[model samples]
Target: MSPVVLFDAALALGVLGCAALALTLRDRTGTVAAFMLTGLLVALSWLRLGAPDVALAEAAIGAGLTGALFLRGARRLGPLRARPPAPAQAAAAALGAAVLSAALLWAFATAPAESLYPPRVAAALEDSGVSNPVTAVLLNFRAWDTLLEIAVLVVALLLVMTLSPPRVIPDKLGALVQPFARIVVPVAVLVAGHLLWQGAEAPGGAFQAGAVLAGAGLALVLGGVRVDRRVLRRALTALALAGLAVFTLAALASQAVTGALLGYPDGQAKAWIIAIEGALTLSIAATLCLLFTGYGRRSAR
Candidate 1:
């Protein structure tokens, strides 16, 4: 156990080191690479602390989605790298960082281990229709919060759609990348399904599953695969809106039966939650892919 503790402590230090390198690195691309590494290390720390769900989220979103976003947007990134500040400015920055870190530590020390929210979630766990407390809380106890979160995604997609034009990824991604993508894309799809299915009982969930699918979609894009514009629009819209539409419909249906929004019928909550998660997985993938690469503008093969 002490050895395990030492390993965890070492991992935490590694995470901090990677984060520092990410922030301080002069090379823009290297900085982004370091950021991705930091995210992976943070995910490992989350696993060490016994939070697989958070670990998965950090890996998928913080490392994967965010890194892809940075690379994708790199086309617009200016060639100018940030210059080092004056010594006085650097000292001010260091002081600000220390203050923030101290404040965070203080807050963590003062905060209770278990709050009222957890007890409520625990009390309702059996009736929440999911064995996993995190899933139950997100989908049952705080379904409205989840709905709002989905809405935020939709708004982001809409904003991106307005700003970005249809994308046509270059077809000449070296021979090695293309061949590797062919194998990876299918496996990622399969893994996404597994994560979605396992979320009901474990750390896997719609967000993680959707992120995996988005990663596959990104690979496909980079491999010169493009769907027709009309086809792409129809499919992406349907897939991206699936979650919001399904959840809203479910809420209305629940209101009719239980006199409350998103209220699942007795003994049928699991099915409802699962269905909602499935649609969300699709929606999230579509939305993310769109944000990364924009709409396809060529003929489908």
Candidate 2:
């Protein structure tokens, strides 16, 4: 077989094996570890599909953040996580999975070869503001979808705030962790900014930038860095709202200037998109970090 086909076959086997192991693993922590492996394999599948943006998202939110969350929960739950599911529950789950897989296979097998949106997007690219087709689609062509996605993040943060947020790190690794974070967080920030800038012309964008910033935040949190609780709460709330506020105001401003909402002025699409994405990246990062912080039982709350 060709190298590409051989590689794909290996990746497919790895993904399937990991997924099955994740489902059958008895220990909660081991299950989470297997699931993380599956997520990484799925991310590689996205890369193979030639979708770097989707791959980045899969790596960041899917594999990275999810693994961290599961690890945290596993640490807390300990032996309770290993409790076996009811036999009926396990059987039902298996049946559901089988049915869903069959349905998806049937859909794809019967579907047409062509898509309806790509041609339209290509035709409209020149006037869509950003040079990158993905960026233009997100921040210009289908801006309402982007706006709603940010709003969903805002809603998630608000929901998470119903519980106490982090007051301190769960377990401080060591003095070495602080120095390590000092080295890594700055680089993460620089990379995030670069991704934001590159999004206008490449596969990077606000989501990827936000995910990098969230990783930095997670590292700092786990490294025992924290602000006053009140300050942390207010700052997180503001950051969580930043994207929505900026995006909504921008939409209004656009509507006032143009005849439609989110419509950038002629030839000024790049500038507008950059400004919106800058705000969005910070908001998404903070929101994601907050979700992690509020996930489990709080200490001394």
Q: Write the residue-wise lDDT of candidate 1 on 115-188 in tens digits.
A: 76767777889998888887887888889999999999999888877765546465576769878888999999
Model 2: per-residue Cα lDDT over 194-281, one tens digit each? 9999999888999999999999998888887867756875797788898899999999999999989999999998899999999999
TM-score of each: 0.91, 0.91
At residue 164, what lDDT does model 1 achieve?
A: 57
lDDT of each: 0.84, 0.87
Number of backbone-clashing residue pairs for each candidate, in the order shown:
0, 0
Worst 10 residues of 2 by lDDT: 163-172
Worst 10 residues of 1 by lDDT: 292-301
How large is the C-alpha RMSD of every model relative to the true structure?
2.9, 2.4
